[model samples]
Target: EKAEALGVPAGPERSRLVRGESVTLADGRIVHPDDVLGEPVPGAKLVYVGDASRVDDLVEEARGADVLVVEATYLEAEADLARKYGHLTAAQAATLAREAQVRQLYLTHISRRYSEREVLAEAEPIFPHTVVAKDFDRVRVVKQQ
Candidate 1:
């Protein structure tokens, strides 16, 4: 806007152009000129959450993530135990992924008391993209239009 303020105006004069000092995102996030842009083409975004019970800002933090790796330590039926242990239920993790709009949801840090099939069954109805993490399993996240 400096050009407009100073009446530098626009035309064939390349030098008259003024590059804004900052770029503003729709969410009101500001990007400085010196900021480092992450990822390359198709820009993948991954959010990793450990054994958290309830993270207040998790939804905002994981918004638009291509992949969200979070803990699902128990089934919804054992929500009380999950809360007692500061862990999340399978359904809770799925809800978080859905709210965050992540493309893929990987459930991890499961408790020994529960089976992977049970956890998967609890989450799949809420978020169809949910995956019950297996040891040494690998997944590639790619941005989609």
Candidate 2:
């Protein structure tokens, strides 16, 4: 909007400005580049892990992720079963998301013994952004300016 408002032509000059390079406007006004982006738009980063039981270096791998999708096949009550089956519990997935500093967490591949609410209950306390993923559910993470 700033570019449009300032009459930055919708071509090469605009492209340069978008790349964080200074560009002189048609009216001879110069727009300085911003370290964080002159615009509010930001690229998203998504990380998805399936059927994870071992998370030793997962935190470092998923650092700064905008969205994380991991399987939580059991509640903490069945933590032993989760470990035996090589799957994560809801709490485990949430903890992974928190430690990784991800913006959003989606728990998937849950066992039929528990409802979505039950899975969310165990995860939300550890990470407020936790969600029980559904089939074909699309998540879009937009950062605040």
Candidate 3:
């Protein structure tokens, strides 16, 4: 669980460095901070939003993400219920994807009341890249050149 155990130097300033950027340590050792960061591949912004009822608050964080994984726990017909339970509807999830301009969107945490088809139907029209996530489904988000 230590960053150094994973070959990444642990420190407060590590996150602020970008790819190919380097910093010199007090002990005279040089470190390329980005080399130890997550997402070894370049040109992709990956985001995951869970248990979020409101997407409006996440607009800035989700902007221009290559892939966004979010929750759609209710159908549009159950908007009131979704709000009460602090969960997003399929439509709302799609709206968030559209607003964020994410290249791909995967919807998860669906309520048992709706089928996978129903969730996809509600989201696809709003955001063409939307998909319903099933158990153990693996999705790859490749950055477009």
Candidate 4:
């Protein structure tokens, strides 16, 4: 029953991802990702992180996500520096969020050089739903209809 509550199938192989199969929770919620098995719980709050850089690969995985928390390690003016360190700039992170169609984007792991205002200014135009995460910031993720 514990497995069932978490939406994992019962038996030795408690959980496995099979294409086209969705795990149904006890409360009738369904969990499924666009690709791959063992992805985060669906129909619940989902947070996808691009880590330092190379967020390009996360586009598909992040589609329809509630919140995409990616690194915005530098301002757009320092794009070259960001690339050299394998990190993303504010604008790049915003663009990724737009392409993925995520509901909201929270930019984190920022470099010390940039102020929160600078980061927000760079990202807001490209993706209006973007926000720069600060210490102890509380954000609520709501599921879209």
TM per candidate: 0.69, 0.68, 0.71, 0.68
Q: How much is the lDDT of residue 51 in candidate 1? A: 81
Q: Using TM-score as the measure, which candidate wins?
A: 3
Among these predictions, the greatest lDDT belongs to: 2
lDDT score for residue 31 of model 2: 76
Note the residue pairs that clash in candidate 2: none
Candidates 2 and 3 compared by TM-score, better number: 3
CA lDDT, every model vs. true structure = 0.78, 0.84, 0.82, 0.77
- From the highest TM-score down, the ranking of the candidates is 3, 1, 2, 4
lDDT of 3 by residue, 1-145 (tens): 3235434445544544453567565567666654455665567788999888788889889999999999999998988988998989999989999998989999999998888888888999999998888899987778867
TM-score of 3: 0.71
Give lDDT tens digits, candidate 1, residues 68-129.
99998888888898889999988989999999888999999998888778888899999999
- Which of the two candidates, 1 or 4, achieves a greater lDDT against the reference? 1
The digit string of per-residue lDDT tens for model 2 on 41-129 reads 45787889998886767999888788889999999999999999899999998999999999999889999999988888899999999
Better model by TM-score, 1 or 2? 1
Query: What C-alpha lDDT, on a 0 to 100 scale, does residue 103 get in candidate 3?
Result: 93
Clashing pairs in 1: none
For model 4, residues 30-114, the per-residue Cα lDDT tens digits are 6553333455555734655654556767788888788888889989888888888888989988988999898888999998988
